[model samples]
Target: MMSALVLYVTDDCSLCDQALELMAAAGAPDFQSVFIDDVPALQTTYGWRVPVVHDGHRGRELDWPFDVAALRAFLQPG
Candidate 1:
């Protein structure tokens, strides 16, 4: 089964765009995207770290600068 994952992102973010590309290359499972632009708390937490992959099932977060392999590992179920 696929794990629950959330991709925290923002508008006009190049890195976030790259993250989507990497996820596709890594064959990522179904996930939800949450924009941080309008949420103050989200902005505070992920302002500098857009394109973050949050593993809701494991309560883990994978920050940017991750490659396809890393994304694959993050998408793996426990």
Candidate 2:
């Protein structure tokens, strides 16, 4: 099975919503949304940076305010 990207986000976060839209616009690879609120570790790690995209396979993370070019690069293999 292919490893899916993980998107960390919190409820009612406008930036998170923008990130989702950007991902769709960038034709992002398969990904799963994880609410940081539900996971303590995640909440602690990404509480301040809610709209984060974790590339588990590459062990990299893309923070918010990224453009399509950056998104494509983040999706690329290392």
Candidate 3:
């Protein structure tokens, strides 16, 4: 299986928490959470936009507030 990492980018955001729950429910794959505040570039690039899933190998990114179908599609075999 391809190794992908979901990046939950946010800073003290309740929405991020909700997104985490949503991802959990959607059976989202194992990932490394990256807080926007931790990185200047991320904070600048995704200001106010939290909960993103990123493909470590492909360098692709998917925004949050996604459904199971979206997650499934993102996690599909490539």
Q: Report lDDT (CA) for all predictions.
A: 0.89, 0.88, 0.73
TM-score versus the correct structure, for each prediction: 0.91, 0.90, 0.77
Candidate 2 backbone collisions, by pair: none
lDDT of 3 by residue, 1-78 (tens): 544675656767877787777678777777777787878888788766677888887787778677767877886758
Rank ordering of all candidates by TM-score, starting from the highest: 1, 2, 3
| Model 2, position 70: C-alpha lDDT score | 90
RMSD of each: 2.3, 1.5, 2.8
The backbone clash count of each candidate, in order, is 0, 0, 0
Model number with the top TM-score: 1
Give stretches of model 1 more than 4 Å off.
1-3
Candidate with best lDDT = 1
Q: Would you give me the overall lDDT of model 2?
A: 0.88
lDDT of 2 at 67: 79
Runs of candidate 2 with Cα error greater than 4 angstroms are: none
Give the alpha carbon lDDT tens digit for every residue of 1-78 in model 1. Answer: 554888899999889989988888999888888899999999999999888999888899999989999998877777
lDDT of 3: 0.73
Q: Deviation in angstroms for 17 in model 1?
A: 0.5
Backbone clashes (count) for model 2: 0
